[model samples]
Target: MKEIDCRGLPYLKIIREIKKYFNSIGEGEAIVIVNSELGRSNVLRYAAHKGYQLDEENEENRFLIKIEKRGCLEVEDEGEIFSILITREKLGEGDDDLGKILMNEYFEVLNEYDKLPKEILFLNSAVKLFHKDSMAMEEIRLLYKKGVNLLINDTSLEHYNLTDQITFGEITSMYDMVVAMKRAKKLIRL
Candidate 1:
């Protein structure tokens, strides 16, 4: 088994490193990853999302996760691979003020979907919705708790000066976004 010492590493960096490691290994091969307490849940979620069968344990002050690369995507119950990309603050091209209201309503309507989108990605101006003061906070939080992946572009957060104000989702890079979109069976851009 390959061993990865990820203590003190940020959760996203650990996720990226683990993914790189998985890409280099063959199916059925296993890796042992050690993470700090703060990163344990994120690591577990990432491993599961990537279709790795995992066995984990607490050792002293850290978590040891053994992950086997399955070489396949985890099959969702509905078997649909869909992602939503939001590049703007609103749902359509129209009045700026009204668009904000519409966007909030749109999130509320998202709950009606029988099968929620696998990922909800926010970029550019859309990333503002991830800030603590967002009107769509309630709906977005609900979606997150319901197992939908929420991703916010790091560049966008920086541009909006909201990198520190965000209260939800994983802050992601362009590379991550591109990779995720490529793997998505269906992608909706709004």
Candidate 2:
């Protein structure tokens, strides 16, 4: 294993960088080392929020990573965990207006949190937020601006004919969804 030096990057930047590496390489792992415990924990918190786990042996204030294969990453760090569960269409079922109200409330709740959920995964009718004409477009845009990751189902996009128009994140597979959910600390369903 190579001991890479990633000393100066911010937590989110490093996460994005690592994700990029994973994208191009299709698999690999890197240990994230920061100058301070706060930085390490900040990164760790996001990992945990996304339902990622640590190697049981990792000590507090440190980050450990060991690649299991080409594409899977295992990170261990000591920090609080948070989870956000989104498995629905339009934020809720039944009345459309009520669902809109609830979706706004969901976004507002996330806005108030000190540490938001690791990601917002959309499936089925839930993928509507990415539409250019969505009422929640601004709120979702704000969330993305704040470093929240957005992932929509690849097949869902095909179903809705949303393969174009969207200028955000990526289209993801169910396998990726499983990994995301596994890293989340708590899951909130709508």
Candidate 3:
């Protein structure tokens, strides 16, 4: 069995390193140690997404995840994999305050849906929605907790000078955003 320690790493780096490790190994078992709940959740999601068998053990301040890469298990199709694209701070053109209210309500309603989008891509002014003080922060965080990939545009973050104010989501490039759009079964643009 191989062991990979991922303590003190960001969630994205943890996922990336684990992915690289799995790709390099053959049929074998590996143990991943993570110290944060977000890291643990991301690892579990990655394992499940790849159809790898996994078992988890909780320790005093960390989680020990045992992953076995025997073969990919058949994953049943759950239906259309859609993505939501937000290009503005608000939902529609109108009074800024009303638009803010509408956007907040929209995310709140989306949270009630049985099947949420596979990912939510934030672009342009929509990147502001990820700021720690944004009104929609709660809903966005909940969406992430529910396994919806929150992808924020890096350029937009820099444009708005909000790169450090963001509290959730992965900072991604325009190329990644285009790839996600192309791969989505359906896209809901806002």
lDDT of 2: 0.63
Using all chains and alpha carbons, the TM-scores for the candidates as numbered come to 0.58, 0.53, 0.59
Using alpha carbons, what is the TM-score of model 3? 0.59
Runs in model 2 deviating more than 4 A are 1-78
Q: Each candidate: how many clashes?
A: 0, 12, 0
Question: Which number leads on lDDT?
Answer: 3
| Local distance difference test scores for all models | 0.81, 0.63, 0.87
| Weakest ten-residue segment in model 1 by summed lDDT | 28-37
Candidate 2 residue lDDT tens string, 79-113: 55554545554665689888877786667656644
Candidate 2: C-alpha RMSD to true structure equals 12.7
In candidate 1, stretches whose alpha carbon ends up further than 4 angstroms from where it belongs are 1-77
- How many clashes does the backbone of model 2 have? 12
